[model samples]
Target: MLVTAEGAVRIWTINLPKAGNAITGADFIAAFEAAVDAANRDTGVCAVVLTGAGKIFSAGGNVREMADRKGMFGLPAIEQRYAYVDGIQRIPRALARLEVPLIAAVNGPAIGAGCDLAMMCDIRVASERATFAESFVTLGLVPGDGGTWFLQRAIGYERAAELTFTGKTLDAATARNWGLVSRVVPHEELMPTALELAGQIAENPPRALRMAKRLLQESRTGALESTLGMAAAMQPLAHHDDEHDRRIAKWRSA
Candidate 1:
């Protein structure tokens, strides 16, 4: 994993493209945890963009490891369950805890667990070469990582169900049509577009951006009244922030 910052936007690139960028056991989890930790520690970082090196975004779980019955996949049924809960599942959980907005720049195939990874991001921007699939069924396994939960929420239950059951892949255009990705661009333009969007998000007051993201996340599972109460409570905090006052003063002078 390689993490670099472009101003207030952090870019995290998964660098194992030779293996189709497959995520092996604890490596991915540790890298992601570190990246999130770094972002949290850096007050200047307001947004993040995640992408892959080389041609493929990610192939998801390590298929070779699964086929050889090695690593996490080789454990006993109960042990396997625990491994997923304690290991691979950490990626989504870590991402969920992030206050800054995240954007996925899908440069190529994002299959199986890879698809779930993109779904965890707050926004997805795909290259025209990008393809997505909830391919667990093809390998005779279920979505061990949070694909089931994220996929349905991304493209709706019906569409997610069909893809999961069939293990079919969708092109960038189809994914955009299904609301899985917000924008599709040429392969070379993927990161630039994602960074441009991230820049826009990073321009906002950091505290307000984090609070707004928290409110949106809460609304996903919380009741409407509960979300409204949170918004009401958070609004005053934003109003009192120095960044808010500075921006207001600048706007009034203009």
Candidate 2:
């Protein structure tokens, strides 16, 4: 992965173009996890964008390895389950820790776990050439990357089920219509559009943006009262933030 910064936003590019930016094994996850940690620790980084180095955003798993019964696909059924727990499952957990907005700039085909990866982001913007597929079923396999959960949350249970069962591929426009991706731009414009959105998000006060992100995350699963109570707890801290005060002052000046 190649990580670069633009003002308050960080762009992470998956660099395995030769393999269609396929993500697999321990090393990739560890590095990605570390990158997320680094972004969180840096107060200056208020937003992030993830994209691929070449045409494909991600191929998801390594098909060649799966065919060879190597790595996570090796051995007994029970061991395969454990391998998932220690391997791919860790991605959602790592992404869950991000305090700011995460944008997936889907440049091309996001197949199977790749589709799940895009779903894991807080926002998704796709190139006109981009495609998404929950393709595990086509391979006579199931989603081993928490696509079960993420897919439903992204495009509703019914839509998710259809894709999962049929392993149908969706074009960028179809993905946007189904609410999987927020926007679909011409392929050449994808990165520019994503970066522009990231800049908009990055301009906000960092602490407040983080608090809003946290609240938004909790609202998805928490009950009404619990979510409100959590917001109440965070509001006072936001009220006391120096940056918030500065923003207020700037507004008054305007």
- In angstroms, what RMSD does candidate 2 have relative to the true structure? 0.9
Candidate 1 lDDT, tens digit per residue, 58-141? 999888888899987889999888988999899988988898999999999999989999999999999999999999988898
Show the lowest summed lDDT stretch of 10 residues, model 1.
20-29
Q: State every prediction's TM-score relative to the real structure.
A: 0.98, 0.98
lDDT (Cα) of model 1: 0.92
Leading candidate by lDDT: 2
User: After superposition, which runs of candidate 2 have C-alpha atoms over 4 Å from their true positions?
Assistant: none
Stretch of 10 with least lDDT, candidate 2 = 19-28
Candidate 2 lDDT, 63-153, residue by residue in tens: 9998998876777999888888888888899998899899999999999988999999999999999999999999999998899999999
For model 1, state the Cα shift of residue 36 in Å. 0.8
Tell me model 2's lDDT, rounded to 2 decimals. Answer: 0.93
For each candidate, C-alpha RMSD in Å? 0.9, 0.9
